[model samples]
Target: MRIAHATAATAAAALLTLLGTAPPATATTRPAGPPATTARPPAPIAWGSCPDSTADTRQQCATLAVPLDHADPTGPQLDLAVSRITAARPDQRRGALLIVPGGPGNPGLNGPTNAVRRLPRSVLDRYDLIGFDPRGVGRSSPVDCGLAHDDLSMTTLLPWPAPDGSVTGNLAAARRIADACTRNGGPVLRSISTRNEARDMDRIRQALGERRISAWGVSYGTYAGAVYATMYPDRTDRIVLDSNDDPDPSRVERGWLAAYATGAEDRFPDFAAWAAAPAAGDQRLADTPQQVRDLFLRLAARLDTAPLPWPGANPARLDGNALRAAMLDTLYDDARFPRLARLMLAADGRAELPPAATPPDAAMQNTVAASAATMCNDVRWPRSADGYARAVAADRTAHPLTAGMPVNVMPCAFWPTDPAEPPTRITPDGPSNILMVQNLRDPATPYAGALRLRAALGDRARLVSVDSGGHDAYAAHGNACGDRLVTRFLVDGRRPAHDTLCPAEH
Candidate 1:
């Protein structure tokens, strides 16, 4: 869910803790048992400065220790970084609102700072914003596969097939990366799984002394948040899941990856319309949306055979796969449409190539490793290379814009370890305190997938279908109607009696 954008920011991590309040009453049933976790609550944090000097001065940080394996509470533990920005009005405080981030690898230690800027004061007055980095990411015992810098490229991390749609190279790369991770990734990396992440959230809740927690989870975080809600229904208050991924337990990350094709198709028209507009000026690719699409497809195919020289890029060239990757990244937000249009122009020999957008090598290493670990550790993927070839072939024909990359072989196919536990199946058996806001055309977590998650949560959730494009909905994408509704839910603890829609801004 953390797809790289034209200028995607690198992730960072740190730690923090906060005091908690007993949760308000909810309709959720608390399973009758001596609690699931028997470990005593951790001591309150000695909060201090955040690692990033730029983080809001008020955002305090600290670290929590959680078991490397939740199954063994007394086993070796790892540091979990957390951050918090306390409520402005303590008298109106409700509880801690955990800002769960996306990208099984994305860091959330800075989430409080990020959320504080966009969230309304009404909500801020009622809750302390809390954030944390899941294990194996950033400062929380970060792990790396020590991958060759070349494999760290977005084009490679994603299983983009050979120009001829061959799976031979993709399969080899998958095996190679899988082997490297196994050789270098220690127990910390192996311990990275969604289930463990949910368990860690519970630990954070206990450490804060909160009987319950509210959360705003985005993209991949949506899936993580759902698991936490389902597993600890009684422990959750107001829940907002933005840009959801399908919670198909059987497929899990596999389904998330494959959804890219559908996502690209769903979002491309928005980009085309933006790029082809008369106001686009020099960045415009074509006179009409259809012409823009045709131009991009033609340019990509042309580059598939003859790449344009791009100084300073990983491969030092702009090829079809790289172009495809750029397209996906730009589709995340409409403001990035120009980035893709410029690339298309350059690929077509009408303009000079823009500077390569590369993230730091170390961040890429940690992200790629953690991402693969979570995806593979959550479920077992088919190991057959031939099967991948067939799927890629079919997906390419079905979704040409993505060129079969969505269905291509990934390191998970050759993962060194099997999943430790089965994927969590989200059910309607939780507090009906969940609110979901989704863009109609999110290139990463598509609207169709959000619908699936909405269906899975059943009576427990109400969907705010925003008629817009791009990722993240609430307080993002400029839809006042959608933003007001989500903020109302977080501050007032009120949700629509049924699903609703927020029409696109004209």
Candidate 2:
């Protein structure tokens, strides 16, 4: 899943436990582009003991049985894998805090454990951290479109450009993928939209026996949390959304997908600056910013014409698309700076790619299919081919580094089914305790999108924009100021009176 899951000792244990998982038996349908069909809450969560009986006594696991279709609660049920590492101190606990994961396909089961490592002690001391895979992900009833290995490649998953900016391949790829899912994916896979996931979250809150839930949602999770707040405002307590995305009601996920062009454009400058930094240590790009930019663009163009050969990797060669994939992966975090540098060095006949990341097995393939199902089924993409043509043409001209891939076609184009519910409109009337943190120059989820989110949640949220550049900016980004602000809100329910900006630190 593209959404970054939390990583901590707790998550490690949970991840190990879910080594072999399976999908649920029953399923149903929610109307397209509308609120989730209301289903009965999952049967009581079958709480389990954390296998690490010797570790902190507060951590535990359970299985929540939510409706495969909220529209028909008793009709068909699915098991939702859940985990909770109680607050360090129960007496200090305020309430349960759900860790809403980002990717439409990101599983939250391991998040309860991963999030704690980054959460401030104050917040950890005051809330039970609850995490669960949304329907059709991780251990929670997985779903696959029964796709072949070739269709699961990163380029295919992302809808990147053919070497020469041709849309013929893209159109064919989208049609083929969409057709495959419709033929192979079952009801559960078809039901994998975000609206259903939001409803499942509510069921989780109810199953946990909490009338209200404080939450920390990031990336796509921010969208899920916002939808939850919009749908169940009365049940929300303190909400923390990091690296926010725009809430364009007319085009939710589609809008988020399209914004990548701008995100990449905004973020590449940061990489350029980093690569161009003085040769302090092994950093290698250029000694100047302008030179670094010129260097990358030139290499990409060269690779477009002549790709380098590498073995064991899918597609069997390191071409321009491969280079573009590397760029997206690196932009997710700063520590990956070396990755891009190494790629540049290799393209310049200086080095070779490190071991290619392991290709996803069947489960990973299913997970990706689930993700795509959720994205396409959640909302309708622009129906016109011209829309993509215009967008891609503009994106290529403006952001050559991304090759208009950000605005290119995907399964959404050939998405066989329509939305199940009307997309949720994030309004400012939800609970008053939502705190948002964002970096001005994030390479993935940019500040402009976050601002759009802020505008959507007018009075319901207070923004904490930081002058930084990364995918996430809460506890993950070491801006103590941003961290402290979020901690204060999560722990004490204290929020800034107005939107505030944290100055960038060198």
Candidate 3:
């Protein structure tokens, strides 16, 4: 039941790692064509030392001006923060390899630096690793809805239902959130859709003076990269989409939300086994995986009626939905398993409650607003309350862990505007230069969804499915086999002749 926005900052593999925008006038379809050209082509980037926080003098930063609304190129423009780590061996340089980070709201300014350290020297020597914050994000022109602190909580933002499964509160919250963005998001917010992001990427390519740019896109970024490949086939060189989403033009983000039910189900076994191990110590939940599952179910059901007082938490209590959301988040990475274990320990009266984790106020407001704008603006949601109620009830019965949140209401249901354009339909007509790497049990972008994207691309793409349990695939949770395959594809322009599956890393 964790919202997509909460998973935004989860892919900093190095840290373990540790760990938007505006509104616009009348919505219009994004323009389709070659990268923009002018009497004088976009000026070449004048790179300089990165911010002090980046602490990597080898990385350089620059800014590019892109139209706020691609459909209205003459309208106001926003500056996109861009960064790059030049190829180590210029003589072997192949081209630029752009890193497209996840979260329609997430920034990619530091991605190149991180990627350079993880990628093989062969690839690093051949490509100038590039990264940029998309419009209305990070160092880009950001937009915030100014939502109240409580409303910024993960539990509230995700639309968790009442104890009795009543969605009355969810409906009201969705409306309130949507109204806030409408009132404060301005024209830039309305411009934040997947199609526009792709267009902005093309603008970046033009500014970088690359006729054909290679890319490495992850999670939500996979979808954006696919759209870019679909819309501008000839302009792309090597393309890698890791942990992909289903490119169902009709459902898009709504489909991603619904997939969490199955995704969580697919991934929980790994956690149950981990939690039940002898090494788990006092944090262990049960003697066996089945027992662990039963324990969690019973605990959640009990909390529905009697939530525990949880000081420092937004709602100041540990309710069933909050527990469910925490479980979802913990399932994303095995490294996060202790978070749920500790929570369960506290709930069972075996330990004290851990301090709740809260993101910075400004960061939360900006990311939530941007996530809502992109999800809602990309496609229309079913506005009928009855329809949602039926879907949620059915989903809750089928997938108890998610507790109907997957099909529940979101701010998109109350969005004020229709999608500005139809989603880009992924097709096999594009160049067969795309390589996809995905984990079998990813909690955010599930393997089943990745299959859909693989199928959508037909022979144009090959998938290297890793038998793993986590969100990210390559160089993160993936086995060496999967990593080797991806490295070969990116570094040497070599790809397997067919879709292949690599055994899980032990």
Candidate 4:
């Protein structure tokens, strides 16, 4: 995710939950619901002195010791970092709202703090906001592959085909990365699947003493939310799935990985316009919008034939695959469009790129890899190199913008451990309190993918499509219509009777 400058953030569990600065709501009340959990802590629990980051200082920070595997709940539990900021408005208070973050890899503890600041005072008045790092991530028993310094580069993680669509190099990287993880990751890594995350969430909910928890999840978290709602239907109150994922249980991450092709095709126009604009200072990608596309493809092809030498950068060469990876990562938002344009401009000038932003500590990387490993390892990818070759070749022809990265192989293809447990299946038989908000042109979690989730959820959920691009529309990108819809459901326990589209401008 780095070279693409697209990874979420590399924050640790403690730092993520340690602080908050959000203002408090007018009135207040401690929310209530399900009975307290009967699950015993593995060891004597210790309460530490901590100050509330927000007005909801009623917020408590603690560690939940869940089993590394629920199948062995009492065998050996792992520590899960948890934080909660209860509602300040008593009369209006309803229940707990869990902030499930994106990323088979993002830490959600930070997300609750982020949401607390942006939450409408009315909404903040009534619910306890809970955020956590899913098991095996951040503060939990972490997992790592002990990858080499070189393997850390995102360009190495994303499998992009050779300029001519050859899968040779990609295959090698896949095998290498997979081996590294299998060798170093140990037992904990095998325990990090989305299904396990769902199990962890249920355990957290049980620990929180809540009958149902409302959720606002982004990116891959959307998948977990859906899985949780499916697995623990009665335990869900009002759920808002933002920047959704494809619910093709058959392919899971495979579908998400493939969606990037169309995702790029759909979102590129937005980046092209940004790069072409005169106001785009320092980013001289192309004067004309069409030229941006042409120039990128041209540069990529040229690099394939003659990669420009650039010191300090991963590989020390400005290659076609590197350029393509950067573009795909930067297209997440219009605000990042210039970053990609500048990278393109530098490639043209035979200059080096700035280092991708990363978490300051090794713990963060290990946590992220743990999260990603779970998702990548839980499911199976085609083992046949021939299948990958054909897929990459087809992707190149079908989506030139991505150059086959979408359908290409990842470490999953070679990941040694299969899921220790079966993947959780999502069904619409859950509560009708679920609300979905999605951007039509999301690059990572595209609208088409959201539809698959929508179709899967059926009557158990309602959809509010935002006429826009980028991820997480509910609060970050959701317009008035979408925002009001979710807010009403959270505050008043109401929902739309049918699927709806929230106009971008509204």
Q: Which candidate is the best by TM-score?
A: 1
The best candidate by lDDT is: 1
- Each prediction's RMSD over C-alphas, in Å, is 6.7, 5.1, 3.6, 8.6
Model 4 Cα shift for residue 113 (angstroms):
1.6
Better model by lDDT: candidate 2 vs candidate 3 = 3
**1: Cα error in model 2, Å:** 8.7
Clashes, model 2: 16
Which of the two candidates, 2 or 3, achieves a greater TM-score against the reference?
Answer: 3
Model 4 C-alpha lDDT per residue in residues 58-113, reported as the tens digit of each score: 44667878877565555777788887776878777788888886666655555556
* Ordering by TM-score: 1, 3, 2, 4
Across residues 398-426, which tens digit of lDDT does each residue of candidate 2 receive? 98878887777776767755665667778
Residue 14 in candidate 4, Cα distance off native in Å: 21
Per-candidate TM vs. native?
0.94, 0.91, 0.93, 0.87
lDDT at 324, model 3: 88
**Clash pairs detected, candidate 1:** 15-61, 15-62, 15-82, 16-61, 16-62, 16-82
Superposed model 3: Cα runs more than 4 Å off: 1-40
User: Ten residues in a row with the worst lDDT in model 3?
Assistant: 12-21
Judged by whole-model lDDT over C-alpha atoms, candidate 3 comes out at: 0.80
Total clashing residue pairs per candidate?
6, 16, 14, 10
* Model 2, C-alpha of 190: deviation from truth (Å): 1.4
